[model samples]
Target: MDIPFIDLDAQEKVIGKKLEGAVETVLQHKKFINGPEVSVFEESLAKFANVNNAITCGSGTDALLLPLMAIGVGEGDAVFVPSFTFVATAEVVSLLKATPFFVDVDMKTFNIDPEILRNAIIASKKMGLKPKVIIPVDLFGQPACYDQINEIAEEFSLNVISDAAQSFGAKQGGKPVGGLAHITSTSFFPSKPLGCYGDGGAILTDDKPLAENLMSLRAHGSGKNKYDNVRIGLNSRLDTIQAAILIEKINILKNEIEKRNLVAKKYSEEIDKKIQKPIINNGNYSAWAQYTIIYENRDQLSEYLKDKGIPTVIYYPKPLHLQSAYTVFPRYPKNLKVSEFLSSKVLSLPMHPYLSSAQQNFIISSINKYTKEK
Candidate 1:
């Protein structure tokens, strides 16, 4: 038998019936776009995140894009983002013709360094670019240091849009990820902690006016009716089927997050002490989207695990700053040494709520065996 990487099959076995019923209900209604379920899911999501409004969208990228469009980010505007995160964090800025000024991440948290962000903002202004927004990413299910980021944003008069695609169910300082920043965006791409069946995403915010603008921007910027186009917008509504599926998934998200934490604890406690484990800051609870560790010979370890029917993946083999497409962008401190170094050393092991102890034990033992020999 093969060890499953995410074991979505196991998750399906637990909630398959509920998921099927949700889909069936959507099919019966036959209202696929902007259906009743969409609003219901949005309300549930708002409540879960303890926010005032939640707006559903087409994908994670759209979730970020809609907010940028709402705030009118354009050319000469500089959006600060960590180079260690997924491209979508910076991609949305470039799509709007805004400058994506990359910043270095903390070696410990793998998140944007608040100090680096402040420096980047000053650097942008020095170069004659307007510092517009600060996009802080919650890398590997852990939330970024939002308190510091928010304070800096206030000092600089910038918006904070959290790229929380990997951290929907996570929390920091007893507050959920979606409510930690001025605006939060999360993905439901079937692999996140609280994922739906297909491509779906949502934006969360406490600012009611901003939320209303986002709602309009997601659906052709309509006002009063579909024919009334109030502003330039994109067709980015979530499917009714996917909304129904997410409703069921969200209902049990707390339980699933607890299970994922347990799985993470086992890996942290049992993995070899010599291998550098992930650092989860105090008062921050991770969704454990991926259980990543730093090993000098990451490629060798990954190949050895593959030979043993165990799976290992590198979340990012290359940081965005080093990529050809992003080379032209300016970076703070110029070097981005940490992000560049992590690219070669970091490796992600299988992580999900359905991961079992026996399977976890096998993975840990395999890793220990390989490290011992090395």
Candidate 2:
């Protein structure tokens, strides 16, 4: 049998019955839009993340967009983001007509470097742009250096919006991802650690006023009634069926995260030593969204693994700043050397909660064999 990169089938075997029941319940209710399940899931999600509010949205992009809208980000405002993250991080800023000022990432964590972010904020101010928000991405399921990022935000009076698309089940300083930033956004894309069946995302926060605004913003900016348009907003509502599906999945997420960590631990211990392993900082626990490694011969290993029926993927082969559409945007330090270097070296191996021991051993040995032969 072919080794699947993420065995959703295996996950189904573990929770298929519950998932069916959840879906059936939604079907029985027939309230697909903004149904009862949506609110229940939102409450559960907020509790899981230890936040006061969790507002469900249409997609991960909307999760980021809703917060920006609530905060009134607009033209001439500069939102500092890591150059290495998915485009959605900066794309939301641009959609609001704000400038996406790119910053370099930390060599170890692959997250926005605090020093670089501070410098970027200063430089943006000098360039006559208003540095209003800092959107730090928690790359590869691990939380970024929030302590430093928060300090820098304080110094500059910037709002910190954590793009935690991959780090939802992770923790920093014992606090969950949702509570780590002023406003945290996460994705439930099918591939994420705690994904639902389809595109789903949520924004988490403790500020009730901000939460109220986000709730309004996710809808058509309604006030008192759906027709009472208070502010400009998008029609981004989480489907009831998706919410029901996520409720079942979220119940098992903690256990699944634990299993994922065990798999990551075994891989780290047995994989080739010459290839650099993911560096997770102390006081942080990752969701293990993808167990990525850094090696000079990343493409070669990926090709070799494919030939061996072992699938490997590069999270990103190009940095956002270097992308054609993003080339015109401003970048701190001019070069973004680390983001560029990581783009060339990083390769993600198969990662999921249901990876069997035998399957994992095969992947490790295959990598070692290639390392030895090359």
Q: Best by lDDT, which number?
A: 2
Q: What is the lDDT of every predicted structure here? A: 0.92, 0.93
TM-score of each: 0.99, 0.99
For every candidate, C-alpha RMSD to the true structure in Å = 0.8, 0.7
The clash number for model 2 is: 0
**lDDT of candidate 2 at residue 249, scale 0 to 100:** 92
* TM-score: model 1 vs. ground truth: 0.99
User: For model 2, what is the error of residue 116's alpha carbon versus the real structure, in angstroms, after optimal superposition?
Assistant: 0.9
lDDT of 2 at 22: 90
Candidate 1 deviant stretches above 4 angstroms? none
- TM-score: model 2 vs. ground truth: 0.99
